[model samples]
Target: MNSRAIKILRELLASDQPITSDYLAHILDVTSRTVRDDIKALNHSLHMHGAKIKSTRGTGYELLINDDQNFRHYLNQSLNHVSQEQALLDSPDARIRYLVKRFLLAERYLKLDDLCDEMHISKSTIQSDLRSVKKMLEKHDIYLDKKPNYGLKAIGNEVKLRFAMSEYIFDRSETGSKTIWRDQLSTIADADKEQLDKVWSVIINQIKENHISLADIAINNLYIHIAIAYKRIKSGHQVSLINQEFDEITKQKEYRVAHHIVRAAEEIFMVKFPPEEIAYIAIHLLGTKMVSQTNMSEAELENIMEKQIQIMTTKILDALEAKMHLGIRHDKELLIGLGLHLKPAINRYKYGMNVRNPMLQDIKLNYPLAFEAGIIAGIVLEQEMDVSIDENEIGYIALHIGAAIERKKMQSSPMCCYIVCASGLGSAHLIKYKLKAVFGSRIEVMGTTEYYKLKQIPFDKTDFIVSSVPINEDLPVPVIDVNAILSDKDIAKIEAFVEEDIDHVFEYIQEDLLFLNKDLQTQDEVLAFLVDQISKTTKLPDDYLKRIYEREEIAPTAYGNLIAIPHPITAQTNDTFLTICTLKKPIDWADKRVQFVCLLNVEKDSKEDLQHMYEMLGKMVDNPSLIQQLVQCKNYRDFINTLLAQN
Candidate 1:
């Protein structure tokens, strides 16, 4: 049976109350039918072992093994015997030999009296065994230290000790009893079986392939494979065999090495690779290493990877179009991965590539596709680039562009801002209002704090600061002093401060042209579309529009003539993006009918971006003729063209 199914059964058995199939399905992230199938498989396996799994209506399956205590006792006895046999074979030295013999004979914890009586040794000799035991325990991360009242005891994480013991036992008997080891290992839950199998298979195969006829390959490979698999699994991938085919004589050796590679990849990525991919990569790497008769340097490996990535990009593009039925320009994803690979090398060079100035001739020769992909990807992902025409610019551009795309996909922001005042109440209120008015609401604000209360604040939380009062203390956040009284100049200054604080905020939005309605319609239609898009993107409820309308009734959206902005005051938005609707016919807004209406759904926390948006709006509002042209726009294309021209 598959390990996944076994895991489900184990979970079911462990639960005190009956678990529903649905609950199992959710835990396994599979359908109820799959869970049922897994249960059936578990039952079949149990039956073969002369055991039965009991199931009842409306409840889950449970193991119904008869004479549970006897079974456990038998298993323990078998383990003890194996341990004794291994101890005899491992060490024949006088000191170790005596300790091993005494340990095997002892039925319970060995007191000094019991140890002396069993071995007919002196107290000092028994004390010497204690010392040896302490030293041995250290190797297993166990401490055999004396306690206040207790004489001496082994103390450590119990699970770690158990794992250590399992490894030790497995290592001791390399070839004699495979079934005994397998039986003992079966005690591990089904969920863990796949992982165990993966580690076991890889190491065994490596040992055979490498022609390493050592008895300890199992233990050595186990340690390396487990470490690597853990890394890969954590990084979001599965572990699998690296290679399937090896000559019978060399299969085991190659498998062992393959496990080590899987572990290495896991460590590097800090994520897991799926079992199948792990297996494939392991096998390929083994074959490559064997054929080449040389280890690949990091640079050489990267070069080979670059070629593979090029192929992957082509495949992904084809898959997107053919299978997904979507037009995906994956140049950005490719460039991002490439840039990540080259990031270390780039850091070595002084004066990073200038993105704004492109050296076409140089780019065409060194990195043609990567260069183009990087520029386009950067534009799409970061919404800006500054390339200069000099010194292998294409590689650098590609790297940054790809990095930008990745950052965009991850939706990460580098800068965080905080507003500070005496009580944190008034300044926070004023700053939030002004900043939201300008930026929209995607930027992050750490939180407002009082000047005196700054000591209580977490420094890591603050990235940039806005405050009314002057403070002498140096802080990590970029401090901007502003007047308590709000004014047009104060607003302008705040806008400028935001731009300085985060250079990318406005530039990214402007470059991406996020506010542009791709297929424009009427002004109202555009507004509705914007609302719909925001709602879909943010997963806002249907009642959000109603809430906004109710809020508007109490206070009009329009601040004044030539400035009509509508928004919901509630902190319901996940992100802040503006929707500027230009009407063919003017709509009545507050005191006067306006040709254009800008809707701002500002998130409460994003002050920097909001400030940037406010600045852009302030510039657009300054032009009355431009506003008139927007109102009289005949079509969507004409409106876009006019807006672009103005910008």
Candidate 2:
């Protein structure tokens, strides 16, 4: 099977229902016939893998698994093979990626004929590919300089070129034996690889000698910067840095390691590195890791930790408490951890260094509520210190928040679920046992009883009721319907009630709060419009717009999927409400292009478990399909219907 077949298998795995071939064709930009052929070939390969594609007459194709273990092993093998395979530049998108990589790495002009011959495409096709390549490069401040006879070359600032190369050269998602940057170096010529390895060995040795520990990705990033600096200097493109900046950078211990690393590289590669190059390497070291702070005393630690960081941490905790109402604001461990982390983080921002966060996705998925709190914390710090907090830094902050949330959970009472089963005592006991096995001590099963006895039980004693049979009675608490046999799906249904929030979402969403299909171009215009509309109904703070702008400065509320959740820095409204506005076209919201803006306002000093509502919004941020459906909504009813359907 080819890459297209792999794509077909992936799509099948992602969906639970049968997906139409036409839909797959539209996604892949191919014909329905091609999709069918690919599915056929895919089924042939899956015969031994314990999974096969089943096509319905009028519906589409679905993946039927015979053996879970076999299917998983086969899928892993296939994905690994896909990762190692050579680049397929046959399609327009693939050709554009190849063109961009080539332009980024090329030392000289690349002729149109050469590119056409390389990709086996026509001049017109190559021209179209170049346009896309230019657009992508422009994001990194790199541009294509096309000459009539000399061909096209990449022209940009040296720093921007290195940043672009770091992104394009390595496969970030590689999961094989070879390290990411080393695997990327496999594409380079043997001679260039030899030269690059010399610098890599020197950096490794010097960092080891200095007792500096760096993650694999950080090491790869630093190596790429050094490798780029080496080539540029050899080609007579020395980086220029002011004496004062160089002097200040030299004061750091990383500069000492960078100086030695460069001297060794200068002898092995026989290329002199300017002082500015050493300072550049130092910046990477400073951003990537912290020197052993364990040796410092309590007084020393306090002295080293600037007063602004303490104040910032307090502000962040206050904001988290005010908005999410997560009861982890008073966690001492969180305060110290976040405070220490921010001390170095602020330094990284000051030097304009980029740090990689490998567990960002996992943090977002597993600890979504904590991650949202981290976003709030990041905004507060950004406002206080006047620094840009990227998602990477936010991930580190989320770790502290996640830990604090865990601590808070440890302190809180377990969630109580009263069982309402129509089955006999034996069946009820079996269901109770299954629930206990799945949820452990975190969930307290408050005994099981028949539907008749359910009303006799106190409603305030339990958070929710899990039932084996449907209950027609209007209960005070939410009732979760589950199966008598207690399957995984049944357990999931019960778990949904564990973090469930009150259904105040639609209540707060009035028709007046919604602005659909508006001709808004900038973020400021959207904010002003939403704030002004809300002001007409109720009094707003005089600095409401200023507060919203401040939150944007902390980090963008645009968490991708064309959604931006902009809220005030502090709670300014007495009532909790949302003002939703959808644009006619997408506008740039920080680094993300957003069409939907959700202006959130939490009630001041209100006590409520709003985490469930935040989790629902987080799901919208993670799902593009949901965002698309919400954006298509023309009225309050349609919007509410979409939200209900998704939840």
Candidate 3:
């Protein structure tokens, strides 16, 4: 199958339910007919194997496996074919990725001639690719050391080197090229693929036997850690865990599992692992444990959630509510869920163990509001725990927050309806009972009263007024006049009042604010350019740029995927407007490279629902292909067209 077909299959494998062809087509930037043809072709190829694509009439398609053994064989063969196609890495971006893995896993200086021969490229092309590679390496504090006759070597701190290796030596993208990195690793003489497989088998067995659940990406990270450790140990290097950290880790249940796995691997590989090495594996286990959210008594669960964790969770939700107003603070499930997630997460951060969140970009795109709220939670965590939390941890926290927001949406809160009557209490009672019976759980009758008593009643608690008599008093909520015996039209009107559609947020984007193909170098330069441009039209505060800088101090605005949404610490503009700046090239913005800069100035003393704006930007940040299109736009109209097409 082709790359697009493989991507479709990978997406299908990730999902449990049937995915519609239209959605797949939109994601793949292809037509529905093309997606259908690909599905037909893929199924034809899989028929002789185990799996087949089953399509329903109205529903989409799902992959059904008939023979597991045959499917595994087919998958192995396909992966090997993908490995053999490495010689086809001709594009600049493709070559960059290959060279990154190559340099990161290289043992000694690589000669220019050998590199050219390996990639089947010219000297000038290799030189250009090297410039891009140098930029990437510089971000990780790694420098390219070149000598007259010795060629080029990567020089950096060992820890930073391993971090950089972990990033590029793996297929972190949401595609079917997961094991392709392993194939690349086999080409490295120092990396023993067979030894790494032994570690992988040990980890899987321990995870299953101990009933500890881990996502596939987390397991893959564990495998990478083992391979790194093996390589470092063979090269006479070792990672030192603090004595206190080792003590703390040994007290956990994961430590026992790590011990067993380490012993088994040592016996098989005949390599002795120090206690610190075992503790290192235990750290990965502790950070990667998926919360087993199940039914349990409150008393039993309280034992797991310490008092401090509960307080931290409370502070996180409060900050989220104050900043985003997600209206999910009181969700008991959310409170307990965040508390449970933070407990292990706190330990992970205390020991400086960074967990790779494979779905970080996807989570930010799908749940922008929740992800922003997660950022606030990270800030709160930093304050309370005295340890900085990265975006990966924040993404995991967003999952819980997003689930809570969804639960709040699914829960139908009763609309409080108060009855106003001119007649005796009997008529009011009759109307109240009828409304309750009709609306059922949807409407809560807050008690019937006379029209004169309506003034004394608390309208703040009421959503709408059901008045049988003509009440001319202006109130905060909608007043629905209905007969003592409610009519169908009256019910429809009340329904309309109760149900409100979400406001469109992208309407706030002004065409004049868009600036394309600007020559920008640094983060401050981009921010200054945007501020200077918008300051002409809008009345911004004198300390506008300083306010934005302060906000960056609190947390960097770089949200990854070559996108940065920088806003002032507080609202300064007279009106809410989004100013777009697409750079000529990617510039360093703190730790991330950014080319698409969005300066959001919220209206002063204004309360507008801006969740849609965050979601829109999140979509742009998550899709690299979309960002590439956006950054290459030469005009405002082109930018708008590209953005609207995605929607």
lDDT of each: 0.48, 0.76, 0.77
Give the TM-score of each candidate: 0.21, 0.66, 0.67
lDDT of 1: 0.48
Native-to-model Cα distance after best TM-score fit, residue 111 in candidate 1, in Å: 99
lDDT of 2 by residue, 83-160 (tens): 222335324556677788888778899999997787777899888768778977886668899898879999987766
Per model, state how many residue pairs clash: 62, 0, 0
Which has the greatest TM-score?
A: 3
| Better structure of 1 and 2 per lDDT | 2
Q: Which stretches of candidate 1 lie over 4 Å from their true place?
A: 1-332, 335-410, 501-647
Tell me how far the alpha carbon of residue 333 in candidate 1 is from the true structure, in angstroms, after superposition: 2.2
Question: What is candidate 1's CA lDDT for residue 540?
Answer: 71
lDDT tens digits, residues 167-264, model 1?
33232332235444554443322124445566566556665667544324324424333543353344443422224322321343444565565675
Candidate 3 positional error at 275, Å: 4.4
Q: Give the Å shift of residue 617 in candidate 3.
A: 7.8
What order do candidates take by lDDT, descending?
A: 3, 2, 1
